[model samples]
Target: MALNGCSIWGCAKALQPATSTLSLNSKHDLGKCGKWRRCCSSVVNGVESSFQYADRVQVQITELDDGFHKDLNMLPKPLTANKFSSSRDGTKLCVAYKGLAGAYTEEAALKAYPKCETVPCDDFETSLQAVESGLVDKAVLPIESSEGGSIHHNYDLLLDHKLHIVGEVQLLINHCLLGLTGATKENLKFVLSHPQALVQCEMMLTDLAVTNIGVDDTAAAAKAVSLDGRRNIGAIASSRAAKLYGLHILAEGIQDDDNITRCLILARDPILPETNGSYKTSIVFSLQEGPGVLMKALEVFGLRNINLSKIESRPVKRYPVRLRDDSKYESIKYFDNLFYIDFEASMTNPNAQHALESLQEYTTFIRVLGCYPVDKTDISC
Candidate 1:
């Protein structure tokens, strides 16, 4: 169990070949009630022939039981590779994004690592699963969009999964209105895109009388409009998506706000950035029920001069329940909760550690999500 790199063939090689080749033996049938039967087939190669020999060896063991009622014992289970290192080293990072192959998420990942391979998933949660199950080295998920606001599912997923947030990327979101060849705004009657895209372009679309259809993703909307070959339908998506799908650009910068941007989190094993600068540390914790529990929790950060960037409360689903005193209800519910807080200090800072230590007495659960370099690039002119 040393922490050396995982061997790809260790599990396969350790299992007894006879156990893998077990077959039903027909000769020992107890008048059609026997569970064992024979397997007869020609071996294509020496490896398969060796497997057959292993099967014969296993069949002989079952035939040795002479008594009608005999006790049986199962063999020990096989050992598997350590779950953490399966997707490390040269393994490709499987990334899931909400758009097509050439979308912003993919672009950011490529920007981070030029040669890294990418896997396009349908949504954000699927990307998390890919990383959680060791199928991907890391997941790049969008947590906030500058113009549209925060992506809440990703924040919730961070609390649900043990995967760490190691890095982050800020990508400028450039919105484009695309349509098929010969399509024009005057002829268009409907626009299709994701809900966020629709919201971003709300004012731009208001001037026109086109009906808005919310699809699953931006690039998918573009592809649909392109494939449908409709001259009256347009899609709100990225300029790259328009070019990839062979769609014509009807207009550019379609978002109501020009400062649209998205904050993406790089997660696998969370680590503080190497470079020094103003840092932000995200932590999640839950407090025991008390009169001043929340106030005391906030005091820890305030006392240490640690500025909180963001704070939100969410109910903890796993705690025990109790009866309510309210006259409106008869049933009781659990009061467990989780508080997500982002502070303007790195985990490396003494004040940050001291704040957590002070709050630990009242906190039932606590976890540090990540400490990353602040995105100080101003979008405003």
Candidate 2:
């Protein structure tokens, strides 16, 4: 049960199952059924083989902890020479972020765990892999921006990865325009940053008559501009990026609006739920083709008095198209969608549990992404 630097494997015990018998008297066949058949498969080299293992098994619940660096093979990439280490000795939690120290992702990670050691990655996926592989105890990934709404890619990544959401942080975004020394706003001909940052500062860049060039990360963009040493290039990034890259700030708060990006803290294991705190439960579900199916699913929460803060849908990956009959001869095609909902109740709440149970009755597939405490930080600029 010790999760300290260990993986939580499924705890199961096999029980020799009993044979079945049925009666044919109106409702069943009398003493006709035999032992149930079961087989487990395994692949050796490239060949496959099957063997009967267990008929009955049991599973147990497990919680997350910082001691998870023992599973290097779980990493998305091969283990490298550089292993993640705590900034201090080996006591602090090793956290991962998608950018260098100046990136807002790093700020979010720090805000969530002020004393944790933060490691930077080239991209979001690397940070996620770091957590999954036990390179870091946790990862901070931005899920939504106040201006641009939900980051769809992050939402998809949530489904693609098995990592659990353990916490959340809302970081206020105040983007700054940074350029190399002696570079003025008027002289800047191109603005570079992540696509979202570029879009957020669209009007400002247009007014400055600078072409916005989308790049990987805002911090990386700033670093590029600084290294390029071009007066014609400015970067829309954070103030910290400017200082770290030794770039001059041409303008402050250049974003079209004051934004708050909501980040999800990811880990290999789920956090132990607390009953008496303000909490939110996030879930994704898919329903079969039928009228009022979605309505029936939402009604479970309403019936249970569970308030939903957000509900968004994305097209199901494999089967994106769904056909609908508009008329006898005409048909309409729509995307088969998977709904992600955030309800204002913890999973520990009986009402929330009942609501999800009711929801599953109508959904073909459903998953609870997380049930974590609500972030009440004054995330105002």
Candidate 3:
């Protein structure tokens, strides 16, 4: 049955957290007769009180005549807090990271949650979707690099997904040149890596005078080189990738600069951070075009003594171009933009609430992406 635009399971509502831990109690009717029903669950101190969302993907097709019944299994599920607990806490956490098993993103996840179960995904969206679909408890995806700049694709995905940012990790990246055991750097005719990695190691690649090819990710490139068994081709990836794929590390720290990647930890629910600890909040907003309009919106934070950590603008995809008419001139066309901001404060802070309230008066749209604790661990490779 065609179920496009169908609002099944009460619009597939995102689970709302009621306390420091989530204790959801939502019920939705199934089919026309409502005979086929499933009991929704609540999480108390990381334990499931009812149905286990992760292991219930199978549904009987006979119930499809009701339309909503057949499609109910497609809705996203929430992760229990227990699955996020650390090994030290005596609970095993299942976390997802982009790329192969040995990717730098996996290192970041292990650093943040020691002994946690790491699941590998082919791309960033897959990692996020895993967390949303109850396949994993959290996803650690790179958002920015110290030398290569912001990962713009992940920023756009953060806007599209309903997952919340629960934490972050900044890992000092050490890129390595990998090749076959018998391969040498002097004999290599070509190198492969992600676009950002290739750019970061431009000087080194130029010194070798080899053609550089861009791939989906660093670890994937390393895996390809290992499987291809080409003596003249090498890959730029993490040292861990070399070990995982059984490739030789021809060169260590190939990237010209000491690059560090900042990764964000996403989950279905936000953590209740302590008021005494340092926190950061991320928000996205849009404003009407006019003189001093942008200035007026920024003034809210400035006047309240709240510090903004980052600000970026992206063209609105749905309505990229719009016409503006001035009383003194003819109508002019311009691209509409959505502004993303990261600030230093928690949502529980009074000043932050007032700042957002004040900002609402001037903005056409505003959303609080997440309020998460800042990662302050001193990192070393």
Candidate that would win on TM-score: 3
How do the predictions measure up, each by TM-score? 0.69, 0.72, 0.73
Lowest lDDT 10-mer window, candidate 1?
7-16
Off by over 4 Å in 2: 1-90, 321-334
lDDT of 2 by residue, 278-307 (tens): 988787766744689889889999998999
How much lDDT does each candidate structure score?
0.60, 0.67, 0.68
* Residue 163 miss distance in model 1 (angstroms): 0.6
**Tens digit of per-residue lDDT, candidate 1, span 219-238:** 66765665566688898888
Clash totals for all models, in order?
4, 9, 0
The candidate maximizing lDDT is: 3
For model 3, residues 152-175, the per-residue Cα lDDT tens digits are: 888877766767778889899988
* Sequence-dependent TM-score of model 3: 0.73
Ranking by lDDT: 3, 2, 1
TM-score of 2: 0.72
